[model samples]
Target: MYAIGIDIGGTTIKVGLVDGGKIINSNRKPTASTPEEAVANIVLQIDALFEKYNLTVKDIVGIGIGCPGLISSEEGVVCHISTMKWHNFPIVSLLKKTYNTNIKVSNDANVAALGEAMFGAGEKFNNSIMLTLGTGVGGGIIIDNKIYAGAFSKGAELGHMVIRIGGEPCGCGRRGCLETYASATGLTRMTKSAMEQHPESEMWKFVDGDINKVDGRTSFECAKQGDAAANSVVDDFVMYLSEGIMNLANIFRPEAFIIGGGISAQGKYLTDKLTAYCEKYCYGYKNAPKSEIITATLGNDAGIIGAAALVI
Candidate 1:
């Protein structure tokens, strides 16, 4: 049976027809400005998909949605979504009423984790954690082959975990969150700081002195060219990332820790360094089979595939 998967983001809404862990057809549209408009857009997309595939409601098993913010998957309610100004939105019930079908919904990060665990990098392992290091650090945990959203579906906010007592202030109004140091934005900030410190560094040349142009790759690229300042920045970034991973390892001890997002493009270079640091810092690393650190395989389709898995 086929399932429809919808991923709601700040800028876009992605929808797909998924079967057996694969997205058969997909479409994307700009996010609506209001909750009502968003729901209407989703219904329109679902109808379009149905018509395009020549299927009826009975042909689909269910509709699954991955949304941002605090979500109650069981209740199908979006408690709060800062990016979209959605609060206590009854997404599942609304969708169910419109389509008259089974509907499932959960936090976007958690859904992405489920997608990875069921069909991507974590497929081989029963327990795993996925960290998406994009504009911010988004995390998902899987235990015994199932998503583990805490009692209120608010658990697994890994990025908010305080790594330092009085460190950089996070967007979440917290101090020293892991996201402050390990995310793509955080990496750019670090690169900018390094460039400012070493005015003669090659990183400035890479970004042409425009601090805004500096991305997660600026420091790594400059370091590849033997820029000492960039190298130090990378070293510091890896150190903070490894510390966070080690903490997760000691707590969850999952079989694998999967890294997603743009920086993951660094591939083995990133994973190798992270693995080494995790091995050194994780508690009792020598006494047990260490959790492998790897890059996510699903890429952009993770959310769609994962949302579909909620019904499968």
Candidate 2:
């Protein structure tokens, strides 16, 4: 079967075509500020692609879209998009008019998780969680091969799990959320805080004492050098990160844990650290069975791949 997958991110919208779980064509475009315009722009792109391939909408099985907002996948509408300034936008309805194909719309993170479950790390387990530690720690929980969206289409907002009460302010206007201390942004926060406490530490030298200048890579680099400040930052971060994992482990007890997103490029640093801390701190678990916290193998293609799986 052939399908098109679209991921609407804050800055870019990634679109792709998939044939039998493989990406046949893909491209990235700037996200339109208005839902009306975005939908129209997407239609043009889709039509262009079909025209290029000498195919029509009838040739495809479905079109799946993932976006950042409160989406009623069952209703095929986006209820609210805080960043997009959109309310009650019927994205599926708009697309259906053009494609006349099976259309699936859902939260972008959930779609990503779905994709991972179908084709990436989560593929090995019917029940698993995909943790994406990017600018924010986005996540998706897959159980029985379906996304566990909450009643309000707000389920699995795992990034907002309050790992630390009043710890750090989050974009969600909440304090001490898991994303506050576990995401790439959180990593920068940790590095800055560490450098402040140990101005003489190598971390300060690395960033030239410019706290705001620190980033995820700097934290990883300092950690590798065994800098006290960097180690302290990791230690503090692991407290919240492992706690979040422990919470998930205790809840679903999934077969494996898949960590993805940009920060995941740190590889062994994140895996080894997260594993050690999560195992050591988990409650009611004597031995940490192999949960297989593997890095995602599919990378950015999961969105397209998973979107296609909607028809599968």
> Which residue pairs show backbone clashes in model 2?
115-306
Residue-wise C-alpha lDDT for candidate 2, range 1-312, written one tens digit per residue: 788988788788878888877898987778888888888888888887888899988898889988787888888889988877889989888888777888998887888888888888777789888888888898988889888887867789999999878788888898989998889888887787777777778887787767777888786788789887787887777677778988888898877778888888877778888888766767655565656576777788877787777766
**Residue by residue across 2-116, what tens digits does model 1's lDDT show?**
9999998899999999989999999999999888889999989888999999998899989989998989987889999887789999988888888877899999999999999
* Per-residue error (Å), model 1, residue 150: 0.5
Please list all clashing residue pairs in model 1, or write none if there are none: none
In TM-score terms, candidate 1 sits at: 0.97
Best by lDDT: 1
Off by over 4 Å in 2: 287-290
> Which portions of model 1 show Cα errors greater than 4 Å?
none
For model 1, the run of ten residues with the poorest summed lDDT: 93-102
Write down the lDDT that model 1 would get.
Answer: 0.92
Q: Which ten residues in a row have the lowest lDDT in candidate 2?
A: 283-292
